[model samples]
Target: MSNATQTDRWTDSPRARWLAVAVYAVAMAWVESAVVLYLRTLTQRLDPATTTPLPPLERVTEAELVREAATLIMLGAVGWLAGRDRRTRAGYGLLAFGLWDIFYYVFLKPLTSWPRSLLDWDVLFLLPLPWWGPVAAPVSVALLMVLWGSLVTQLPPQRLQRSPPGLVWVLTALGVVLALYVFMADAIRVAPQGRQALQNLLPTRFNWLLFGCAWLLMATPVLHLLIQLTRRQPAQPTASQPE
Candidate 1:
């Protein structure tokens, strides 16, 4: 077979598809773990007393960005492979995110035993809110991603209905807003705090509620789609109708 045909055959095969995803995930985890280790070392080297109050936007070194970018490029390749089939791409994306997430924690255990428990604090992401919580927080999100992926991939093609593009845009916007609220919560609380207080002013109870509500909202689209897929259908009319 030609090289292109051989490549196509491998990607189309179930075993190859899964193996590719697993390898991609492992590479991503390794890169992330290494970057984190380097960052911790950098942090230790810095003089905490003399460092500026605000973190630098380019704190991550050029080498680190190159490594991270390579990992992301690999992830995008896996996404492209997984998304080859429209029927199952959503499922692939969901599984890709979840597995990548869970394995990141798994690989980090040996590199640095930081999170001893599920409640250990973590910076989930860097964008707006920097998600903070125990290890369980992202794990929960990963599980949800898996659920959404399974639902998307398993549904029959006949049952799949696209929501209005406007509705999709609305949901996407709401999701971003909710995510920001959850992430910047600490910053929001600090706005009213006294000098030298590095803590968030928001009550723990409120934070928990907000987090729970945000998660539920994220799950809504997937849940609705799943219901549509699983619902029993009525029999179709016969060709021999009464005259």
Candidate 2:
């Protein structure tokens, strides 16, 4: 084949899946950051660490919350399309989420000097409730997701044949719930008073120990998978070979 044809084939190959996902994630993150920039510009809540981080409820309408939900759906759809099976689909989803999250900060730093440091706090999500955490928190999780997702997606098929048990998933789900609780603790505390109270609240402390435990628990399946892959033995010869 000609060099050009070879290049094209390589670009279309399975090995290039990560590249495609990364490109799409970067673009999505850029667009999302731009949207946030516009919103901050409009609301004048540019610095997330200020006393009043979130805009008044009037300024942040239901539409904005809906848009966030829509973004998640879109991310999930991209993963579904990129992966060949459920596990790989989940890997792609994590890959997309991780890249989008990391690049959200990357694209934001240039536009808004917010998140001055990794320790800077911000409002994370608003589905069941508003999640609050330092920039380092989600970034740390995203990095782990990238690592796990890469392993899941790039490992040889034979290495991935050993599926994680149901107990592992249960532990993972518990870990997720614990982590969410940690993030939403402040918001939940103020929720009874209403949106204003919740928005006005600033998190004073983060339970790092609990978060660490949760993070390690969440990593169980990935670690187990890796162990299995490592312990996997080569198939033995079906017949004796002549010396």
lDDT of each: 0.60, 0.85
Best by TM-score: 2
lDDT of model 1 at position 129 = 28
The TM-score measured for candidate 2 stands at 0.91
Q: How do the predictions measure up, each by TM-score?
A: 0.67, 0.91
Error of 1 at 196 (Å): 12
Tens digit of lDDT per residue, candidate 1, span 1-243? 799999898767654665566567667777777667667556652212222322343545345446555655666566667665754655565667777888788877777775566665565553332345556767777778767665555555567665524564466457646755766677556655642333222223225566676777677667677677688776778799688
Q: Which ten residues in a row have the lowest lDDT in candidate 2?
A: 52-61
Candidate 2 C-alpha lDDT tens digits along 145-215: 88788888888777766578898889999999999999999888899999788767888789999999989
Residue pairs with colliding backbones in model 2 are: none
lDDT of 1 at 85: 70
